[model samples]
Structures are given as structure tokens and as C-alpha cells.
Target chain A: MSEDKNDSFLSRLKAAERRSGLKTEDDTKESADDKDGQSLATLALRAGTEMISALIVGVCIGWGLDKWLHTRAIFLIIFALLGGGAGVLNVWRLVKPPPV
Target chain B: MAGGSSIDVLGQFELHSVFGGLGDALHFSQSPVYMMLAVVLVLAFLYFGMRPAAVVPGRFQAAAEVCYEFIRNMAIDTIGPEGASFFPFIFTLFFFILAGNYLGLLPFSYTFTSHIAVTFALAMMVFVLTVVVSLKVQGIRFFAHFMPAGASLALAPLLIPIEILSFLSRPVSLSIRLFANMVAGHVMFEIFASFVIMLAGFGVVGDVFAIGPIAINVALVALELLVGVLQAYVFAILTCIYLREAVAH
Candidate 1:
């Protein structure tokens, strides 16, 4: 009885393996085609998010400094411009392909 | 289409206490409840799936192994040979976000990742780890990363702050990407679902028209599923990339 149970378990495992193997092979082929489309979408999203975030950070830093140093709009204006520049730089770096 | 009420799309993200008394007293909201649920589900999957350790492996076991191998390979591929040490961290991070995303797809479940707080915390952890690793590996030289190798001296005043701002924004960008994606997808789902309800109120013809929104919702769900996995993959891969930069000479 125990041996029979073991044999059944082994057969079930084999079946599972075969099923998964077939699924994975098909998945790899489909994903290869899908990768290009997906990466482009991801890149666009990444670029936009990075640029906005960098600008926000720069502005925040500038505003905080202006408040602390009791400067009027001097630091704020400078930092906002710097922040925008940083944001553009971030987008550029993000879209550029990595160095080989 | 006539006199339809405005849909409260953002209302779905409002926080409310779960488990009644206990949750109220502790100020514990649905977000943490779903986060804990995600953690438990991940643990259960790993435990139950690995329980049957057969040579050929059963379906559950195979799934568990595949998850393990996927993260393992990703770490190595992105972070190089040293990636082995960080596999467990990346694995946990990937599955946690994935579970949160998938769980949110259920009828009434809250998506913890939709909250910027949670994603920011996760991103901050990654940022802190990268900083620590860079400092540990490069020591004082880590500061040199603020300035490019061949930059002119005159540009230092302009470039250093820009570089620093970009560096500081990593966590912000990382958190916003996931949070925005989750929020946008969920809001779209809500808007479409509300359309189905609103259209159904118009009678038989309206009910027939409701099919349009329903069909769009079905497609949206499918797209959201793809987005969930893709976001998780992106997060993990980005973490690996950061780690790779940290450890590199």
C-alpha cells in the first residue's frame, strides 16, 4: 500500500513538471515579444516621475533654506531654476541607454 | 448618460478602521490590515508550497521554486555575482509589493501600495541600504560620487547641488512611481465600475449600454494585472541596479 502511494505521488510530480515546462516555454516566447512594448511604457513613466520628483526636491530644499536664512525669494528662485535643471538632467539620464 | 451623478473615485482610498473595536482603539486602518494579510499570504504560500519537497515537484512546490529562482536570477543578472547576498531582501521586497498589488484587485480589498507612506517607507529602506553599502564599500570615496570625474572646476558650484538634488530624489521617484500607478489604476477601475452602476439605473436600454463599461472594466482589470507584475519587477530591478552601483568600483 505504501509503495503504491509513493508511485502515484511520483507520477503526479512528473505530470506537474511536464505541465509547468510547457507553460514556461510558451511564457518565454510571449514575454520576449512583450518586453519591448512594456519597457517603453515603463521608460516613459520613469522619466516623468523622476523629473517631477527631482524638481519637487529642489524646490523644497530652496524653500526651506529661504525660510531659515530669512531671505525673501532669492534662494527660492535660484533653487527652483536649479531644481528644474536637475529634473531635466534626470530625465535625460533616465532615457539614455546605459554605458556598455 | 443624462443627469448621471459624479463618481467619487478618490473616496475608495479613504482609510477606515477594520476589526471594529480593536482597530478603532488602536487606530489601525484597513491599510495595515491588508499589509498584514499580504504578509501572511506570502508566508503561507512559501510554507505550504515548500512542504511537499518532491524531486519532480508538485504544482504548488513548482510555483514556490519558480518564485525563488526568478528573484535569484534577477538579482544575479542585475547586480552581478555579489547579488547572491542580497537575494533574500530583493525577494521579500518583490513578493510583498506583488502581493499588495494582487490583493487590491479583489472586490473590496485595500491596496496598501496606493498609499505614498508605505511606498516611501519601502523606497527609503532601499535608499538607506544603498547608502550604507556604498559607504561601507567605498568609505570616504563615496562622497566623490557627488562630482563627476572630468568636470571643470567652474562647474562644481552648479553641478554638485544638482547631483545632490537628483540623489535625494531617488526615494521620491521610486515611491511616486508605484503609488501613482496603483492610484491611477484603482481610480480607473472605480470610475468604470461606477459607470456600470449608473447606466444600469436607466432601464433596459441603459442596462444594455452598461455592457460597454463592463467590457472596458474587464480589459482594465487585465491591464492592471499586467501593471501589478510589471511594477513589482521594475521595483526589484531598480533596487538591484542601485545595489550594483553601490558595490561597483
Candidate 2:
């Protein structure tokens, strides 16, 4: 029912992939996808959509809490900052340079 | 204590509280504790699941093996055979998150993954780990990943910066994807649950109608369980895709 037809040890890449459990395709290896290299900024911008939403939500929640507690925006500022920091952090994690 | 997003993302069964609480801080900040609980859960699962490695294999072992194999297949299929080495890491990540997720589904427990800090921290670890691996494997050549195969010198000026920008955006997508999904699922669970609880004590009509929320909650809990695994898988697998680019590039 199942088999290990393709098995090889490449090195760091292999280790990372295996750990992530994110298999793409085999056969030709990682070749087939040479479409005009997609720009890194494009993906980053796409991800920005999520970041922006998080920021708005964090800020609104914090602000609403401030309103509830009558404590101004103390939590709002912190949450907002955290939200922004998270946005930048996401960029740091995913985007990568193109292959040579 | 469970607030924010709630759909009972994991088939949130109402868990009996295992430990007494410390204070409001401990009660509100349930991430670390839940994570600790999840770790113990995994240990228990492995202990019971693998102690009797039989020829025929017991249901537990069979089930555990299936979990491992599924991820194994995912890694091999996504990352390749070299991915076998990552089996431990993937398994750990999968179980840890899975446990954390289910733990939150427990009644009155804080869902750590629902918190951005926790999710971001986890995502950041993966990001940093991948970078370290790439640099170690490729050496100085790793920087060359910035350049595309055949862009003209003129185009490089514009395209290269764009490439760099996207490269930097990984963590944003990675972290938010997990955090958002978890939070969203949980929120749905909460809203539906509140509906059930509020409507449950109204006598005959309320009692008869209570089944609606119960049924919905049950279904939601089941769906959330699937989502918990799905999110974990997506997070781990995306790491593989990004790693491929890092290593080969």
C-alpha cells in the first residue's frame, strides 16, 4: 500500500524539510519551477494583509478595554506595539533571497 | 480564562481541570502551563503507545505510527528523503502544538497558541533555525540566493530589493497564519458555546433546544480538532518550502 521509493540524504536542506514535513515534489527533484522568478516583495506584501488585520484587531481590543477600564490606552499602546512588532517579525521569518 | 478567538478549533471536549490554579496571573496566562501539560501528554502517549512494540502492534502503537507516518510522508513528499532526519523535530512540533491546541479546548483553559507572542515565538524559532541551516550548509554562497538567474543589470536594481523585501516577510506570514487561524477557530467555539450555555437553562423549550448548541458544539469541536492538526501541518510544511528556497538558492 505504501513505499519508500525515493530516499536520499542531502544535508541541511533535507533535514529542515523533513522536520517541517513539507514535501513539494520528487522525480526531477526541485527543478520544474523556473517561471520568471517571483519577487520576494510580492509575497511580503501579500502577508502584509494579515499583519494589518492583526494590528487593527489588537489596537481595537486594547482600546475597547481601555474604554471599559477607564485607564486610557495603556494596554492599547502595548498591544499595538506588539502587533506591529509581530508584523515586522513575520517579514523576517518568511521572505528569502532568490536562488542563484 | 479561554478568551480571544474560539471555535473549539480542536474537538474541544470539556476537560476536567487537572491542577488547581495559582492566581489570576496563572489563570489568565495559561500558555506555558498548557504547553507543559501537552509535553506530559506526549510523553504519556509515547509511553503507552510504544512500550509494547508488537509484531501485530496494538491499536495505540498503530495509531501512533500512523501519526508518525503521515508526517513522514508529508516530509518526504514535501522536503524529500533527507527529511527523515527532521522526523523528530516535525513530530515534536506536531505533537506539542496538537497537545497545546487540545489543552485549550479544555473547559476554562487558556489556549497559548491563540496568543500572538507564543505563536510568533514558535514561528521565529523555525525562521532562525532555517536561516542557520542554510548558512551552515551553503556557506558564503547562501547570500547569492538574492540574485535571480537571468535578470539584466538594470532590472536587478529594482527586482533585487523586491526579493529582499519578500525574504524578510516570512515570519510575518508564518506567525500570523498560525495565530490567526487558531484564534479564529477558538472564537467561533466561544460564540457558539456561549449561545448554548445561555440558552440551556430555560426549562422545556430551553432544554429541548439545548441540544442544538450541544450538537453544534460537538461538531465544531470535531472540526477544530481537524483544524488544529491542519494548522500544525501547514506551519511545519511551509517551513520546509521556505527551507528549500534557502538551501538551494
Candidate 3:
């Protein structure tokens, strides 16, 4: 009885695997490669958006602070530059290869 | 048709209260109704799909298992060993956004995710979670992350603010990306669909031209399907990435 159940389970696993259309080792590798390519695209997309958003956030913060402090453009200019730098830093960290 | 019959593309986004008196009192609209529907659909899919849970596994069980494994692998692959703890959160986020996107594609349904308010709220939740996790896991050391390991002290004045700004922007970027993608896709779909209707009003010759917009609309549907999945994947993976950073030594 135990042997029969084990056999049935094995057969079902194989059937399900086959039905999923990922039959061969080569197909699995191809899919992995495709995922890697997609990951790269995802990284690129994240990098650009991250940079711009950071810059915008910085400018907003700076402008708000300047307005409250009644300190004209000083905070705005400083924060905008800082924001740009931060944006670059974000992109750098995002795209940099993981440390071995 | 008169020249005044221009495509009211943006008008589709307008909100109106639903459910009669209750809707009016609560100021609720179809957006919330569709949101609830999306939630119910997702719950039903998971519950029905996994109901059998057979050793041999039927089709619905298999689909449920596949979804589970896909998200499990994603969390583990992106977040390392600690990924298991956050699996449920990531899975829920992915499926919720995905269900919302697909539900909106149905006629007369609203896409809540397309709204900046909804997406921003979701993004802020993830952002707050990341911050809380980082603080809990790393204590005061979380602040150290703002300064690059090798940066000079002389540049501290400039570097610190910039790093802080970038750190602050994660939620904004995440929210905008999802919201913009959903809005753009739905607007294009509405435009092309309206074009088909407009052209068809002109009779035979116009009906022939309508086929062009129809074909484009079909292709756009296929593209939107791919995009819905892609955006969900991106959102989930990014969450994992942020969580990974939070928990990292």
C-alpha cells in the first residue's frame, strides 16, 4: 500500500511537470536567461525613476523649508543641488553589481 | 455625428457615488466598489484554487501552487534567507495590484490603482514598513546607511542631505511608476476604443476604417495583459529589495 502511494505520487509529479511545458533542462536554462534579461530591464527602469523622484523630493523639501524660514532662495538652491546628487547616488547604488 | 462629438477620453476617470443612499452618505464611488470586487476575486481565486489540496493536485490546485511557488521563489531569490518571513506581505501586494489592474480591463469596472491617491497610499505603506523594519533590525545603525562607507568627512554637508533626499524619494518613485503606467495604458485603450465607435457611426466606409482601431485595441489588450503582470512583478521585487536592504547587515 505504501509502495502504491509512493508510485502514484511520483507519477503525478512527472505528469504535472510535463504538463507545465518545461520538459527539458535546456528549457529551464533558457527561462533562467530570460529572467536575467528581465531583471536587467527592471533595474534600469527603477534606476531612472529613483533618480528623478529623489531630485523632486529634495527640491520640494528645500522649497518648503525656505518658504517657512522666509530665507528666499538659499534653501531651495542648496536642496536642489543636494537632491540632484542624491538622485545620482541612488542610481549608482541601484545598478552597482553586488559585492562578492 | 457632429464635430462636437470629440472623444471624452479623460471623462472616463470621473467618479460618481454608488449604492444609492449609503454611497451618497459615505461619498463612496465605483472605485471602492471595484476595489472590493478585486479583493473578493483574489480571495476567491486563492481559496477555490487551493480547496482540493490533493497530493496528485487537480488543475486549480496546481495553479494555486504555481502562484505560491512563483512568489516564494521571488522573495527568496531577491531577499536571501530572510525572505520567508515577508512572503505573505509580498504575495498579497503582488496579487492585489494585479487583480486591480485586470479587473479594470473589464467593461464598466474602475481601476483604483490608476489613481495617484491609491497608489501613493500603497507606496507609503511599503515605505513605512521598510523604515520600521530597518529600525527594528538595525537599531541606530540604520542612520549609518545614509553615509556611504568610504565618503570623506569634508563632503558630509553636501553628501548627507543628498542621501537623505534620495532615501526619502523611494515611495514617490514607486507610487508614480505604478500610477503612471496604469493611467497611460487605460487612456490609450479608451482612446482607441472610442475611435472605433466614432468611425463606425459613418456607415460602411467608416466601418471598414473601424477595423484598424479594433485591431489596435486587441493588440493593446494583449500588451496590457503583459504589462499588468510585469508591473506587479516589479512592485513585488522592489519591495523585496527594500526589505532586503532593511534587514541587511
Candidate 4:
């Protein structure tokens, strides 16, 4: 009779946990760890692409402006330098920790 | 696939008119067709999954709810309460790319995301939306962001252009990342698949060696599955982040 009561109590607790959609502390931590690993990979990928894309955008704009103005590589040179700076800035923004 | 003795790896990306004359006349390509198919598939999945909305929730209903809640939580958490207003857009973007990525993994299917044109279009849309939202939310103050706070006025000329370039690079980076990742994965698949085919030509010993490439291809498929979902998640979360900045005081 005591064993039967214990089983019923355990079942009731399980049912309440399910109803509340609560996870054990371990479950939440494990999932968070997994997500952190994935996001790290994503951050690495974003850094390289972000840098290159910024440079590309800068070069393209510079080339277009030079062509329109007949500046003979002046705009291109200026833009390329600016674009390179922007690329570095982009990478910096990506890797820097968020402000508190 | 191996065309004669040479591997035509890039042949898979070529666009061709489907449905014979009708498609040709309409200038309809496989990219848009697959996009439509992806849309239809997502809608049908949601419709059927939710139609039997039992109180207890069946397996299909559970899966649909999980998807909904996942995007809902992502948006709300990333963008605050204003995210609810943008939930539909993020959900649609996430699922659309997710569907496109997974669908492309199937044999004889085109991965539209592999195209820079398609990804750029999507990225531009997100970029424009964020800009518009910022302009609306912050008024003329939106231009102030081009000049970083505490920056000296003497360096504004050089810094302003660099800032603008970095800002413009958002869509470029967004599009290129997705496009490049998809293209690289598919190209690797094609190369490995061709290796298996090429190796099979030398009879029994060749067939035995072909297993090496086949194994790699199998592993690649698993990796691609992860890549597909991860890329979708990254895209959606980045959108949320951008929107958060846009709406912030």
C-alpha cells in the first residue's frame, strides 16, 4: 500500500512538470552550451564574409564614381583605402562584445 | 555528374526553362518554380499540421507549434516587444530559406539560395526595411548614426565615408555569406559525386575505390543538413538584431 502511494505521488509530480513545460536545470544548461558552440562557428564565418563584403562595396562605389567623374583612378584609390578601413571596422563590430 | 571523361560540376547551377514551350515563352526558370514550390510546401505543412489542433497536440501539431514558438521567442527576445509586429516577416524569411536549403539537397533540385542574385534581393529587402524603420522611429536622427558619437569633427570626412561603406556592407555581407556557403557546399557535393562516378569506371577495383568518395558524400549530406538550418537561423537572428537597433531609442 505504501509503494502504491509513492508511485501515484511520483506520477502526479511528473504530470505537473509536463503541464508546466519545465525543464531540469541540466537540460537548459546543455542546450545553452550546444547553442554557444554553434554560434561561435557562425561568428567565425560572419567575420570573414563581413570584412570582404565591405571592401567589395567600397571598391565598387569608388570605381563607379571615378568612371562618372573621369578622375583617372583618384576616386578608386581613395575609396579602396576607405573600403579597407570599413572592412576592418566591420570585423571589429562583429567580434567586439556587446555593451552592458 | 561526369559528362564524358570530364566532370561538369557547374552544370547543376544552370537555369533552364521548365514545362516546355509555356515556360520558355514565359521566361520561367527553375529558380522561381522551386521558390513557389517551397512556399506551397511550407503552407501545406502548416495547414495540415494545424488542422488537427487537438488540446493534447498530436505529433504534427507539436512540430508546427515548435516552429512557431521558436521564431516567436527569437524575435521577442532579440527585438523586444516590437518583434511581435515583425514576427510574420522573420518567420517567413526563416522558413523560406530553410525550405530552400533542404529542398536543394534533394536530387535534381535547384538551390536558389546558391545564386547571389536571389540572396542579394532578399538581403536588400531586409536592409531597406531596417532603414525605413530607423527613419520612421528616429526621424532625422537616423543620419546621426553615420557619424559615431564622440568622434572628432576634424575626421568626419574620412570617417563618414567609411561609416557609410560599412553600413552598406550589411546587405552585401548578408547576401554573400548565404550565397557563398550554399555554392561551396553544392560544389563540393558535385566534385565528390563525380569522383564516385569516375572511380566506378575501372571495374571491380575501381568500384571498391568508389566507396571512399561515396562515404565523403554521405558525410557531406549530414553537414549540409546542419549548414542549411544554421544559415537560416543566422539570417533570421541577424535580421532581428538589425531591427532591434532600428527601433531602439
Candidate 5:
């Protein structure tokens, strides 16, 4: 009985292995190489947060610098723009098309 | 939720002392209690599950081995050969978060992962570890990554700040993602549960209508289960990705 169970388990494992191999084989080489289980919804969720967090950090730094320097809004203005750029850069990195 | 018409969805997240007056005196809350429980649970699982150490393996051993192999393969595959060195850290992190998430699904359990403070602390640790690893592996050259390979020298003033800001955002985004996902799932669960309670208050017809929300809540629980595991997987994979970049030098 135990032998039968082991044989069944082994066969099921082999079947699973074959299925996964086929799934990976069907993907493009680049995706297969770097695939880390990110689905579309996950990427979407990540991209939104990536952009916003960078902007938040940039604005915080800018605001702190302005306070330290006793400047009105010079540093704030500059850093906000920089932060916005950083946010775009982050989103770009996340959603950019895979390499050819 | 005691009062009619007040949803009180967010109240589920409130942290209060447990274990009677001792907890109040110590300022200890359910958060730490749950965290300790998660830690003990993970430890007990591995210890008891693997105590037999049979060659053929029992059902409990198989479960333990599957968890081990999943994290082991993920770390090695994502971070290359150097991943072996970081496997223990990654394994602990994955299992801890996984445990906390799964534990939260149980009625009356608090989820530490849902707290911004807890998630931020975890993310900051990962961020600091990656930075340390990069500095150790690549030395002075680690700073070079802030500037892209082909950027003009004149553009450094603009580009460097953006790059630095982008890097600084990593921990913030990582923390927010996990916290937000956990909080959102739990809040939705509570809101739907509230609907069932609220609807049943209206009488027999209301009781029949209340079944709708109950059905939805059941579905939401299933969704929450998937989200809990998926969020844990995302956190682990992102950690591996960051470590890969750090160790790539």
C-alpha cells in the first residue's frame, strides 16, 4: 500500500514537472530568463506605488532642505521637479517593454 | 459596529492591549503578541515537521520540505550562486511574512503585516542590507550606479538627484505595497461582514437579503487567502531582485 502511494506520488510529481517545463518553454527567452512571478495586476500595483513613493520622498527632501536653508520655495520648486522626474523614471523602469 | 449605520471598517485595525492589566501597564499590544505567535508557529512547524527526518518523508515533512525548497529555489534562481549565502535571510523573511499573513486570516487574530510601521521596518531592513551588500561587494564603485552609463557630465546635476530619489523610494514603496494590500483586504472583509450584520437588522425580508452579503464575504475570504500568499510572494521576489542587483558586481 505504501509502495503504491509512493509510485503515485512520483508519477504526479513528474507530471507537474513536465507541465511547468512546458509553461516556461512557451515564454520568450527574455521573460523566461527574468520571470519572477509578476502578473499584470501585480505590476500595475507596483508601478503606481513606485511612482508615488519617489515623488513623496523627493518632496519631503525638498521641503526639509527649504526649511534648513530658510529659503522660501526655491529648493522646494527645484526638488519637486526632480522628484517628479524620478517618479517618471521609476514608472518607466517598471513598465518599459522587454528587451528585443 | 455596535451602533446602527456606522460601518466602523477601520476599527478592526485599532491596536489595544491584550492579556489583561499587565499588557496595559507594559504598553504591549496585540501587534507584538501576534508577531511572537507567528515566530513561534514558524519555528514549531519546522521543528516538529522535520523531527522525524525520514528518507521517504511523512506528510508533515513534505509540507516543510516544500516550503524550504520553494524559497531555496527562488533565492538561487533570482540572485544567482551568491543567493545561497542570503538563503537563510530570505527564507526567514518569506516565512515570517507568510505566517503573519496566514495568521491574520484566522478570526480574532491581528495581522502585523497590515501595520505601516511593521512593514516599513521590514522594508528598511531589506534596503539597508542591500546597500551594505553592494558597498561590501563593489566598494567605491557602488556609487557609480547613481549615474547612468551614457549620461553627459553636465547632466549629472539633474540626473544624479533623480536617481538618488528613485533609490530612496524603494523602501517606501515596498513598505506601502505590503501594508496597503493587507489593510485593504482586511477592510473589505470587515465592510462586507458589516453589511451582513446591518442587513439582518431590518427583519425577515432583511434576513433573506443579508445572505447576499454573506455570500460576498465568503468570496472575499477566498480572495483574501490568495492575496495573503501573493503579497508574501511579491515581497520575497522583490527582496531577491534587490539582492541580485547588489551582488551583481
Candidate 6:
């Protein structure tokens, strides 16, 4: 019974894909590469990476500027902390479910 | 709308004098006016882009659709089936910020996004939503996010603070990412633009010499455009990830 059911389901899927004409790896790749196409999890991970990068850079930039202007690490540490806090908050936000 | 404004972000670009605040204070920033203009521009673009309904979509409609689908897919892919709902917010954010960045690139326009305060606000919104959603879905379990998996209980004290700190830094990171990128790019362009103008101001030889900065400015503009869209995408996707952790954990 299970074998028969599986076969029937596969048959329906094939029939539908057939109407679409093309069924190749290339088509799959094309859809995957669609500009607006990306998985939420993939995006989430990427966002996480970007968040880290942005925070680190912001702090470093502040520090560099402070040094250049002879303000020492004052601005650097301050901006770094602020940026770091924001990063964590953003991560926490990712935990929330978005409204439908 | 901005070209004739009574001193706005546009005016800042033109180096016209800004309004004095209460008691002889000069407000120099054009971030606000141009920011509003950017919002209007985004709405107008979306209106025209999506106005016509066609079975075979036009380029504008298709472009709009692509933006919609991209965010939708990003949400679904990151946060599982549970994340499908947040598509609208993510999509709006992506477009709004993207539009703001792009518009700032226009001649004589001030970039609101170059400011930390503006970028920080946007990031804070995302952070707030992350907390709200996580709490709603996971309730108290949201706190458990910092409890490392399979770690020894003895190490919990040291690890928890780091985890918590890491967690709290998201908005700061998110906002600064956009703010830094925009500011740096704009500054470079501004500097180059000044060079071109100053050089050309020198007359014939300066006109011939203006090509260098102009070329660099064009390249930087292209790069800025790419960064704007990418940063928007990055923000939305990060939002999804936090949501996923909330729901899944």
C-alpha cells in the first residue's frame, strides 16, 4: 500500500513538472540564483555575520579617528560598546516572530 | 519638492545657510529633509512600479515582484515555516533603506543614513521586534538563549556574560554597519566631488584634470548602490535568524 501511494505521488509531481516543460539542474540553479530569492535561515546567518562585521568596524573606526585627532581611545571604546549593544539587541530581535 | 525648500538637506548640499535654532545656533545637518524626500521617492517608485497589473509583467512590476519574492524567500528559508508571516516588514525595510541610500547618491542630496542616529534607530526597531517576537513565542525560554548547549555547569558563569553581551550587541552592529558604509562612501564621493569642482574652477587645465576624481566618483556611486541593497537584505535576514532561534529554541 505504501509503495503504491509513493508511486502515485511521484506520478502527480512528474505530471505537474511536465507542464512546466523544463526539469533540469540548470532550472533549479536559475531559481536559486533569482535576485530576490534567498532562504530565511541563510539570510539569518548572513545577517549575523554582517552584524559582527559592522560592529567591529564601527568601533575600530572610532578608535582610529580618536587616535588621529589625539582623543585617545575614548570615542573608540564608547562607540564600540554602543555598537556592540546594538548588535546583541539585533540578535535578540531575530528571535521574535514577525507579523503575518 | 526639495529644490525650492526653505533650507533643507538639499540646501546643505548647496552650502546655503541653515536655520538658526533657539538662541543663535546654526544647525548644519541636512539629514532630515533629504531623509523625508527619500521616503517620498521610495513610495512614488513603488506606486509606479506596481500600479499596472499585467499577466505578463512589465520590467518595473517584475522588479517589484522580485524584491517581494526575495524577502519572502529569505524569511522562509531562515526561520522555517514559522517565519513566512514577517515578509511584509522585511520587504518594506529592504526597499525603504535601499531607496534612501540610492536617493542620497543623487546630485545635491544629503544622506540621512550616513548618520549614526538614523541608522541606530532603524537597527533598534529591528532589535525591539526581535525581543518582542521571541518573548511572545518562547515566553521565558527566551532567556535560555544564552545557556550554551552541552557546556559544563562550572563554566556557565564566564560563558553567560559573554553570550549575553554578544546578544545585546546586535542593534549596534546592525546600525553601525549601514551608517559606516554610507558615511564612508559619501565622504569619499564628497571629497572627490570637491576635488573635481576645485580643479575645474582653476579653468582650462583644471577642466582637463577633473577626469580623475570624476572617474573615481562614478565607480564609487556604483559600489554605493550595491551596498545599499545588500545592507537592507542583511538587516532583514538577521531579523529572521533571531526569530528562528526564538521559535526553535
Residue B166 CA displacement from its true place in model 1, Å? 0.9
Where in model 3 is the C-alpha error above 4 Å? A1-45, A97-100, B1-5, B201-203
Task: Give a tens-digit lDDT track for model 1, residues B194-238.
Answer: 888888888999999999989999999999999999899889999
DockQ of each: 0.63, 0.05, 0.67, 0.75, 0.70, 0.11
| C-alpha lDDT of residue B214 in model 3 | 90
Q: In terms of lDDT, which candidate is strongest?
A: 4
B110-218: candidate 2 lDDT, tens digit per residue: 6778777887788788878788978987889876767777878887765554455445556656677677767777877767776666665577787778788789889
**Model 2 whole-model lDDT (C-alpha atoms):** 0.69
Chain A alone, model 5, TM-score? Answer: 0.60
User: For model 2, what is the alpha-carbon lDDT of residue B70?
Assistant: 86
As a whole number from 0 to 100, the lDDT of residue B69 in candidate 5 is 97
By the DockQ metric, which is better: model 2 or model 5?
Answer: 5
Candidate 3 structure quality by residue, lDDT tens digits, B1-249: 113468677777778999899999999998888888888988998899989878998998899899999999999999989999999999999999999889888887788889989988999999999999999999999999878799899988777877788889999999988887888898998888888888978999999999998999999999889878888888898899999999898
Query: TM-score: which is higher, 3 or 6?
Result: 3
User: Per-residue error at B27 for model 1, in Å?
Assistant: 0.4
Instruction: Grade the docking of candidate 5.
Output: medium
Each prediction's whole-model lDDT (CA): 0.92, 0.69, 0.88, 0.94, 0.91, 0.72
Q: What digit string (tens of lDDT, one per residue) describes model 6 on residues A1-100?
A: 9999999999989887877876666777788777435456445654575468547755766787798989988878766765565565556655667878
Pick by TM-score: which candidate is best? 4
User: What ranges in model 6 sit over 4 Å off?
Assistant: A1-100, B1-30, B201-205
DockQ of predicted model 1: 0.63
Question: TM-score (0 to 1) for chain A, all models?
Answer: 0.63, 0.49, 0.67, 0.63, 0.60, 0.47
Which predicted model would earn the best DockQ? 4
What would you estimate as the lDDT of candidate 6?
Answer: 0.72
lDDT of 6 by residue, B1-249 (tens): 222212122223333334556322555546666666777876776788889977888999998778777788898999899877877777777777877788788886767777778888988888888889889988898888688799999988755755665666667667877777777787677677777766866899999999998999899988788878877777777778777876775
What TM-score would every model get versus the actual structure? 0.88, 0.63, 0.85, 0.90, 0.88, 0.65
Per-chain TM-score of chain B, candidate 2?
0.80
